[model samples]
Target: MAPSWVNDRSYYQEDCPIYFATDFRQIRNSLSHADYRRINGGNRITLSEFYKQYHKYIMLLYQNGRELWSIQNIEKIDLGDVTEFNRMIFE
Candidate 1:
């Protein structure tokens, strides 16, 4: 029985455990209040939008010491496939 947080959602599938580290304050300070609201309080943005806004912070697996199966590109990522690959590698 997986936890509720483990369930799939429109934003991201839970099968792959995504991880990222960033300076929240820096990101927040860079955005205007309205921009923040548009990103965080409105309908989800498309993959193109995501790449445009966050590509600088993106990192794929093994980049910057990230573990295997890490995802950097949101536009072409398949979380389910990443999860299965991770399971095969670790098991």
Candidate 2:
């Protein structure tokens, strides 16, 4: 099956966070802890570990609606595993 988080073009305009809910919370930053929690509600990712390699011009966003935080990248790092993505953001 296709990647669950790989929503098609239509998903782009979704204002609700549930569309990306499963994945976004996995990478949420502590700087946005409260806002993330508020936006995410108690509907957090309860699934087993899964990861994606996100190489963006920015950290873009990992929140629900309006972005709670933003990170610009002058450098890009690709972690082949989701666990690495976790470490890169949290550590």
Candidate 3:
């Protein structure tokens, strides 16, 4: 079964489009406290937990529409080792 947030269309509308984050940690940190409360019931959670809960909806919009795509799948990666590989190569 899909998560409740996936079925809840209230967060996705013409004026309030869903935001996508390629790096789950960055996006999770970017969310305002109110957003966290609204979507996550005010419980503090790790980025992996957040991604496990929301990645489906993010992927849905990414594959179907203009929303940005984040990591294809959530896997265990060392937070300290995460660097912008693209920037190093492209810059």
Candidate 4:
């Protein structure tokens, strides 16, 4: 089954991954603070089960991180607007 979060249909935008990161953080907190069970649409799952369910999204986030890290020659990269650049990179 496809991941529940992929419904957004905004893959390449900065907001898409930001939403995924926030949702993943929430899942992490729920697992940590609530008996190690992930709460998903009223369905509770163990850590391993959670990983199986979200493996695709997890891998996508990992790949995005790798791509971000692969950026070289930061000074040579031209960002037209500092605010937009910060929003894209930091927000």
* Per-residue alpha-carbon lDDT of candidate 1 for residues 7-69, written as tens digits (9 for 90 to 100): 334334223333223333334443544464444534444345555554434533235446444
Best candidate according to TM-score:
4
Could you list the CA RMSD of all candidates, in the order they appear? 14.9, 13.5, 12.5, 8.7
- What lDDT score belongs to each candidate, Candidate 1 first? 0.45, 0.40, 0.50, 0.58
**Sliding window of 10 residues with minimal summed lDDT for model 2:** 49-58
lDDT of 4 by residue, 1-91 (tens): 6566654546433433344555566667775675434534244344565565565678677888898756665556666674356456743
Give the distance in Å from residue 87's predicted Cα in candidate 1 to where it truly belongs.
Answer: 16
Candidate 3 residues lying further than 4 Å off, grouped into runs, are 1-44, 66-91
Ranking by TM-score: 4, 3, 1, 2
Q: What are the per-model numbers of colliding residue pairs?
A: 0, 0, 1, 0
Off by over 4 Å in 1: 1-42, 60-62, 66-91
| Candidate 3, 29-84: lDDT as tens digits | 54744464445434455456657656666666567754222433324333443435
Best by lDDT: 4
Report how far residue 8 has shifted in candidate 3, in Å. 20
- TM-scores, in order shown? 0.24, 0.20, 0.26, 0.45
Task: Report how far off residue 28 is in candidate 4 (Å).
Answer: 1.0
Off-target runs (Cα >4 Å) in candidate 2 are 1-7, 18-45, 48-91
Off by over 4 Å in 4: 1-26, 31-43, 80-91
Q: Of models 3 and 4, which has the larger TM-score?
A: 4
TM-score of 3: 0.26
Scored by lDDT, model 2 comes in at 0.40
